[model samples]
Target: YIDLYNENHMYWVTADMYFKANQMGLLDPETYTQKNEDYSQKINEGQVFYSSMEWDFDAGNAELSKAGGKDKFVDIPWADTAEFPAWISRASEFGMAARTFVVSSKCDETKMKAIMRLFDFLFSEDGSRTIMNGPKGITWDYDENGVAVLTEDCKQKLKENPDYLLEQGANRYLGLVGQDYDALSATQANEGKYIDLRLNKEYVEENMTDADKDYCDFYGVDVPLEVSTKRENQSTIHEGYINLMPAENPTDIQRSITKISDYLQQAVPDMVFSETQEEYDQKYAQIQAELKNMGYDDVTAYFKEAWENAISNYKELTAK
Candidate 1:
């Protein structure tokens, strides 16, 4: 795409242009425009070939709705066999199932009990409701049919402040420390966009709207968690690497990771704009060589050892 443009038209290429070109900002106009006007024009005029993934589907949907369009971004299963041949046949596990919780050693017995109780509550249906929708009569309430519904007041408050629920102390206090996986899972059970199709049978039969059913049909999942669990069970490779604890001596490994990240930041654009396939291959090889020189091997060895130890420990503990 870039080479043909370069040969056919005398397009000015610069460092910034090269970096941003693959993101589909080649003709963003080197001038200022109002943010709203710019986005509306770019989207409505079809100036964007592919929208950036930085925006979640909800955000993208909201933005497009402003210009009288439905959600342009929706979830789709994607697999690249040429780049990841081994992964082609495997059903990769979803990341959300790997929920972990840790209690601070500094906590007393009282605090520990409180934390345990909170965790227990979050596992319950009502607790999940509060985590997701805030207190009754504020963000949500049950209708005559006993189905939970968002209140108009909640919508108004959300319009004024998107973080109204969090600010109003909807979720457990522990959630303030970090993203509470248990709380998050409960919330997903109640109102998760992707998993709404696969809600509990009773909940679905009673609570789902026609629109909700349609959304579920679009995604082809009757139950959100079942789909994730199925993929995880089918996966040949181990899951939850991102959730793993780092090595004790992580400084050198972190440095190497950063170096490789920085190299990719530049090399990706270089490869994309390369004139020929040979040029692209050379750039990729250069990236690999640079990363290898920057202690990539050492970092890999450290993580590999840690992962193996974890597996061994888990097996021993479970066997007992």
Candidate 2:
């Protein structure tokens, strides 16, 4: 999909393969299965890129160990000042662009300094501030103590129910109106004190760029309650049906093996032996239509409608 999309339109193609490759020392098996040929072509074409962010699982494990219990998981420090630059440099040597996720919720002097010269030209202080505070007073605030804070109500609601936060454009950090700074501040205040306690004002001030200051100027807009409610419900479903089952047990592992067997059994008749796209499409469409007729479409439509509405609501909230 990435190569197809990029080839059709010259967009910068980003993939998570670099991190996977770094951690596992190999390409992800799923990626190999889906687009090994295309990936090789893109590598030759110089169209593929890599991104590195906080090493979530590994960092979380480290934090758990430090805390001496599984009761608390730590947030990995933002990648901006971490070893991510070296990883990005390695990817660049392979003729790929490097992108990263930077968060302001936790700012430490050492990490900030490490990233300042390396990523300064690309992200700048303005960009970091924008990402961190989202137009400042609207979505976040500096209290009398000069500590960053989110609106109390927003923080409380999210703590009580995270679905509300995700639904109201809290997790949409890819484009202009991507994240809610106020909500993020609230999250940090509640769950990220470990990071905040380590931040130094001198480092933040010295490293900040004019653009970063500009990003801090705007106030955040409000998101609706309905959006949050729907997100919460979806989150519940995702946790119950998708995340928990696979992560905690071998149910999904067995199911996946079964699926592979079924696909192997079906592939010989469905693709390799078929002479044309028309033949494959005909058979696939027939099966798909049969499944839809058996209530697949109804269930899928319900999920799609909910997802679309949630996105629309988030956009609407962030528009202001």
Candidate 3:
């Protein structure tokens, strides 16, 4: 079939391709058996496959490239057809607004002043550093030239486990209220603060490990992971579908999405391992036909209208 590399089969591709993999006997035993609870743990135990079906764009890309002895890999988009809307090509300079609010009723004169001072510090360079690395001379400190550096002990812990220092209450002053990224979804712990606090690019680079510096040099980025992700997001061609879609989806739409996701989870492995091209195509067609039966047409129509409206709204605001 295609010269696909990663064979872990953990990351999902299309439903048809996945089903074909299972059919062709290409899927790992554990993929069907559900024995491995953690993909990273499986890799650590030497159970890694040849290629990945999907991965996180930031951390996953760099880590995989380094580990797989590959200089680079391209991110391929998933679509039923090659034809896509022109809006997909358009990049917006706008970003999600980081908001702050105050309770006017709760503020006395002194409380109002304190709140104002806090915001003032939060928006400053020093404030950003404080939020990112914590109070100076503790976990992190600045040199004579003002580049942030982690303490020796802090650096040691970071090398052992990425979250070791965080677990020890070092750099924990920022807390949940001040965290920049969504804490629940974030992989790297303290790194999220760099994006939220708008840490200086140079400051971030100064703290990068030698390996990370090499990674940056090869990738043409001046900063480390968190800053790199922020820069990429800023330059992204289109907003993510998740961001544009309704927060509380309609019941039918939710049901359709769940059905499609569940179906693909089971069907993709089989499609990927199909015995022959003819078999693969037959399975593909069957999957597409089945998709329609699973209310895909209704879901697609709903998203089409929603996406068009989102695009229109974005354009209207940008025009202003």
Model 1 TM-score, 2 decimals:
0.53
The sequence of per-residue lDDT tens digits that candidate 1 reaches over residues 1-320 is: 12211322212224334535635646444222237567656655555444334242455545665665443544333332222222212111222223456798999999999998876665454555666556667767766875566666765776677567677666544342222222223334344421111233544444344544555676565642333433422333433333344534578788887887687666766666666657755775676577678887787777778877766765565477
TM-scores for every candidate against the unseen true structure: 0.53, 0.23, 0.51
lDDT at position 93, candidate 2: 12
User: Which sections of candidate 2 miss by over 4 Å?
Assistant: 1-31, 35-139, 171-174, 177-320
Q: Which scores better on TM-score, 2 or 3?
A: 3
lDDT of 3 by residue, 89-121 (tens): 222123222233446786698988888788666
User: In order, what is each prediction's RMSD in angstroms?
Assistant: 9.6, 20.9, 9.4
Top of the candidates by TM-score: 1
Backbone clashes in candidate 1 total: 3
Which candidate model has the greater TM-score, 1 or 3? 1
The global C-alpha lDDT for each of the candidates, from Candidate 1 onward, is 0.50, 0.36, 0.52
Q: At residue 159, give the lDDT of candidate 3.
A: 62
- In terms of lDDT, model 1 sits at 0.50
TM-score between model 2 and native: 0.23
Cα distance off (Å), candidate 1, residue 80: 8.9
Question: What 10-residue stretch in candidate 3 is worst by lDDT?
Answer: 84-93
